[model samples]
Target chain A: MPSIDVCYSPELLHLYELEGKAVVAVDILRATSTMVTAFAHGATDIIPVMQLEECRAYAEQGCLTAAERNGIKAEGFDLGNSPFAYMNGQVKDRTVAITTTNGTRAIRMSEAAQEIIVGAFLNLEAVAQHLRELQLDVLVVCAGWKGKFNLEDTLYAGALAERLQGEFEFENDATLASLYLYHAAKDDMVTFLRQSSHVRRLENLEIHKDIEFCLQHDTYNVLPVWKRDRLVNLKEFESLGV
Target chain B: MPSIDVCYSPELLHLYELEGKAVVAVDILRATSTMVTAFAHGATDIIPVMQLEECRAYAEQGCLTAAERNGIKAEGFDLGNSPFAYMNGQVKDRTVAITTTNGTRAIRMSEAAQEIIVGAFLNLEAVAQHLRELQLDVLVVCAGWKGKFNLEDTLYAGALAERLQGEFEFENDATLASLYLYHAAKDDMVTFLRQSSHVRRLENLEIHKDIEFCLQHDTYNVLPVWKRDRLVNLKEFESLGV
Candidate 1:
């Protein structure tokens, strides 16, 4: 039986050896939720780049570009940090090259793992099933806001932990702490997050609807995998029995 | 209106500036709990040192000494990491120099704060009362196991947050998470900690009773304050109405 641990933020990423462990990257406030939405639509591939120049390089090759910083859209990018942007026809059958303030940085930092899967409340069931199938030690890496721990990512990590409780061994205090939070707040997530620092910060920007939509559970079944610098739906490889 | 925050480990001490804040350091598994016991028995002072040599220097000057590492007593130290050692007559009216793997190190690392007070569930009310009187932003710094977060320290931090919830504003997610944990484990602490990684590791060494003693609430009312390179009971200053 593989074990499960949650690295509370990207700053703690160096403490774990990720050579053979499957890593699930979570940024529930928007980034992973947005990427999962992109895959749920008909987008073929989404390349997550660490720098604006790297995202710009893919944009030069005709990929739609999106970038976010400080909760606002990057001045020159086509899409900001909103998941609703992907629901429109702009991403259907197209590719998106994107960078975000937190999530893409965590994805790039996590490329050393055996596999990197984007996870969110949107695809909770699918991601839990995928982990059960792999049966390898899973490390949930939270892309905290600027190397600091945030509530939403930790809450999402706990929700996955609650779903996979008996199937895997919990590794640290953080794992149990997260499980406790998930159970305490499972009843009404919106109310649970009402006073969180990140939610209030986002609400200040008038994106209340985005926060509500992003918090919905199992709204999509797509699990985006980081492979060779791009994210694709993990189901594409399921037929191969991987 | 002093705000309160909980740092689950020393690794987060850098995230906040400590210049004008009052810090309450906690190492509930043994160090802070033991210190509270030392004060409860009328010990005059405890000087927390980082290195064995620093403790040795204090011992050479006629102060009693205690040191712990890897769940065992240092080879030649006068006492190990048990809180009961202080409840006995060994610490009464004597100054003791001590070193531990986690707690003492956190004390040394937090010297920059305007004030440093050691806290544990044993002296829960005294510490909370003292913080209410200080009227400065309080940072509950958990001396986690070697720069990583631990269960007992976080639980103690949460218990403090629970006691001080409405009187102060919470600084971050870690605070709310700790409060959640304290509430979850409030009913039966020993059973709540049975499966935790550190508790299990400590149990392997057959020091189960120490865990139980450390979790007891209101066992004492001594608040140990760090002053002039030594920790003296805060009650020593109560005569001045502080």
Candidate 2:
């Protein structure tokens, strides 16, 4: 069986040897959710930029730009790191370049993995189904708040583990513990996550609605993959066998 | 009321200003548990050095040294970072310098805090009693796996939050989530942590027994504190009235 491991926070990325593993990048608070929503709304490809300047420079190339710092929309960007913004209109065939605090950094780091898949509670079933089909050793990379582990990401990792139980073997106790947390909180995710550190920080910015929207399961079937210095759909990579 | 904040992972340390908070560093995996055992066995003080070289230099000062890497004891150190090595006869009345991957890094980073307390499952009650005697805002620093969030530390943080309820205000959702996890696992801590990532990592090294020993509550009452580049007893700082 393929070994399933949990990177409880992005900082643990260095400790993992992602030689042949398929990495699932999870930033449940917003980034992955926004990307999934963007893909769902028919955006041709969502380019994840790690730095704001890079995103701005990419936008200068005529792509729609989205940027955020500390939860608020940046003044010059086309949108913020909000899923609601991604779903605001039909974006079919449009190209978007986006930047945020944590998620983009995770996508950038997983460039060396054999394959990378963006994960979020918003598309839980699709992610689970994809993992089951991939049948490769999996690594759930939680994009914690600025290089640290946060609750929502790890909980989602546990939920994924629970869903993929028979298909993979648990590589560590952290993964199992997360599975337990997911079981206990899956019934009431909203209440369970209401007081989380990320939620509290975002709430200080008056963005509780983003948390609610991010936790909605299977809202999008689109799977975002990192390819050619950008995050594109899996279909785009299939042609290249990446 | 004092603000009781639960930092789910050591990487989240940056989010905290630590300007006027008492940080309780909990690493249930081994560091805090071993620290408690060190004190209980009559060790004079533990200098929590982040580098292995520092521990070796401390040995040159005529103090015994202990080093742990990836949950295993370093070959040349006097002891490994295991609670079993810190029992009644092994560490009594001796000064020791220690280094580990995660726990020591947290102690060093938290030196700027108004106060830093080493917390573990072994000394949960003592920590609670100490909290009751004080009135400073408490920041529960979960020394996650290599600066990431791990379930055990958060669970311990939550347990402390539940014990300190009504005396302090919950600062975020991590605190509430940790508290819930602690309650959920209260009946079977060993079983709860058996499948944990850290535990599984240790088990791979044939140290699974350490995990069970580390999770026992109220096994000791000695609280470790950071003082003058070392983690000594909190009483040492009492003279400074801090």
Candidate 3:
């Protein structure tokens, strides 16, 4: 069986040996959620940039720019971190260059992996099924807030670990730990994660609904794969060399 | 009210503005566990070093060295990471330099904080009480395995968040999410975390019992604080400007 290692934060990515593994990057709080939602709603691809200017520069390629900070949309950007904005129908067939406080950084950091797939609660099922089918060693990269572990990412990792358990062997303790947390809290995942520091911070912003919505599992089955400096549907890779 | 931020991994430490917060470094796996047990058994002080060689260097200070890897006692070390080892009267009145994979790294990373308290299930109450006595903002830093997020650390963060709900304001949604997780898992925290990646990794090494022991709450009231490249007993910090 293929083995999987779970990296709970972006900083831990370097500690992980991902030379040949398929890296499943997760940012459940909003980035991955937004990406999956965007794809599911018909966006063509997302060019993930670590810097705000890089995202702005993508505009030269006719790409839409989405930026966010502290839960609010960044001014002068075409989109925000909110998933609803990605679903506004203006995203269909459009290419988006995106930058956020945490998720994009994680995606950029995992570039060395043999393959990288965007994972979120919305697209979890797709990610799991894809991993099981590929039968490659997997690494679940959680884009914690600014390189720190946050609940949404770990829970997503736990959920994936739980789903992928029978088909894969967990290579590290983090993989098993996350699966255990999810198994124990799956029944009331949203309630269980409500007190997490990141969620509490968002609550202060009155975005509790986003927290509740992001926790929903397997809501969409879109698989966004990193390719050509962007995350597009896996089909984009199949056309190249996935 | 003081605010509590549960950082699931040390990597997320940068996201927090530590300018004036009292950071609680939680490593439930064994570092905090051993520290608390060491103090409970009357150890004069516990020094936490991120590197094994640092532990050896501290040994030059006329202290014992307790090093652990893969949950096993390392060769040439006076002690392993087991809480029982520290509580078995081997650590009383002795100065020890301890090294472990996760907790020690967490302490080192938290050196940037205004204050850093070593926390675990065993010392949750003491940590909470200690934090309550101090009016500064608080950040719960989870020393996850190798810079990754682990369920054990986040659960401890959640547990502490639940305990301090009335006394602190949550700085973010992550805190609220962790508190929710703690509440959901409170009935059987040990069992809830049994499947965590960290515990499972340890279980493969036949140390599931350690996981159970690490989750026991209020087993001791010893608070460990970071100082001069080590996490020593809080009392040791009376002269360090704490």
Interface RMSD (C-alpha) of each candidate? 1.7, 3.3, 4.4
Whole-model Cα lDDT of every candidate shown, in order: 0.85, 0.79, 0.78
lDDT of 3 at B212: 79
Of the candidates numbered 2 and 3, which has the greater lDDT value? 2
TM-score of chain B of each: 0.95, 0.93, 0.91
Instruction: Give per-model CA RMSD.
Output: 3.6, 5.1, 5.7
Q: Which candidate, 1 or 3, has the higher DockQ?
A: 1
Model 2, B82-129: lDDT tens digits are 787776476776898988888887778787788888998777877887
Tell the DockQ for candidate 3. 0.37
Best by DockQ: 1
Point to the candidate with the largest TM-score: 1
Q: In candidate 1, how many Å is residue A208 off?
A: 1.4
Model 3 superposed RMSD (Cα): 5.7
For residue A38, model 3's alpha carbon misses the true position, in angstroms, by 4.3
Q: How do the residues B76-187 of candidate 3 rate in per-residue lDDT, one tens digit apiece?
A: 8899998777655677779988888878777777777888898888878878888999988998888877666566777788888888888888746566556656766789
Per-model DockQ against the true two-chain complex: 0.57, 0.41, 0.37
| Chain B alone, TM-score, model 3 | 0.91
The CAPRI classification for model 3 reads as: acceptable
